[model samples]
Target: MTDKPLGRSAVYTVLTTGYTTSTGPGVAATVSYVSDRDRHVIVDPGMVAHRDRILGPLAELGLGPDDITDVVLSHHHPDNTMNVGLFPEAWVHDHKAEYRNDQWTDRDAEGHQLTESLRLIRTPGHSPEDITLLAGTADGVVAFAGDLWWRPDGPAEDPVAPDRDDLRTSRLRVVAAADVIVPGHGGAFPAGEGVPL
Candidate 1:
């Protein structure tokens, strides 16, 4: 993979399942990912519902499960990691602080260092397994905050997020570290020295 700039390459919001179908906005799962050469890395595989809609965007980018090199899970919650089992071939990455061993390979850091262009950060709040992937090409920091933050209002924003305390500490990490934040289900949030959000 040649050295390149890192930014959001994908996102998938699927309908919720179980009792969630009755109340609250539908759940969403985002794929904060990037590609290098032919290999790809994905973060948080939302829900199994509307599978085609979930994976279709990637297909448009000419990506498939076989092309993925790593699958990083931000948390073990059903909405964020339910689809992980589908990618047995990819190296599954997640924070052991929250998730348990299963079919995918695991890691403790927030962003696993795949190359000089990548690094994962353990920004727990949304879940014990909560993590934020940062991309900086020996230059700057780009944050991918999984459920650690999200859109305030959306019909499909099922944020059964962990207590705000986790979200709070996680936000602290974001403030201390991130440059540009790609929140799970919201518009982009720029991280900086401004007053806390």
Candidate 2:
């Protein structure tokens, strides 16, 4: 009920700025690293030009795959989930559950708090199982919205959305809650720029 962030020190870094081609075969999911309290979270460790595109930056940050505590997937698309095996030790979070080695704990992503400042919100429509990771930082809330948009300039409409209304509603919710948005396939942008109304 408060507009204030949870007052925890959360830091986020976009390890790889992703891209998608209009003409041919090239794409990479934008990946991010968030650290809050005891949690080292990776958002969308998906397809990249190379594994080093993901691991190299992580190495630069002094973290190995073993150091990660959680991996959050916005949805199940292969492009957004290919490199998940890189972090074998982290619990994987999706819209409906958390998975680790041999465990699958079912839980709703809505309002699922991973840390004081990091939480999950169900934002279906990019896919029915889509979820967004909200990280509360000193600047404001940062919404890691996978395919909810391919980029800052949204597709205007998601061609493959099962429910366009749901996609729009989800987008509005994210726009309302986040000061910055890191799209699934592009660099982060301020919430106000070319956001779908």
Q: Which candidate tops lDDT?
A: 2
Q: What TM-score does prediction 2 earn?
A: 0.95
lDDT per residue as tens, model 1, 4-59 = 22533323222222112322367656555565444477777766457665467667
**Model 2 scores what on Cα lDDT?**
0.90
Model 2 clash pairs? none
Which one is best on TM-score? 2
- Model 2, C-alpha of 42: deviation from truth (Å): 0.4
Question: Candidate 1: lDDT over CA atoms?
Answer: 0.58
Candidate 2, residue 151: CA error in Å? 0.7
The positional error of residue 40 in candidate 1, measured at the CA in angstroms, is 0.8
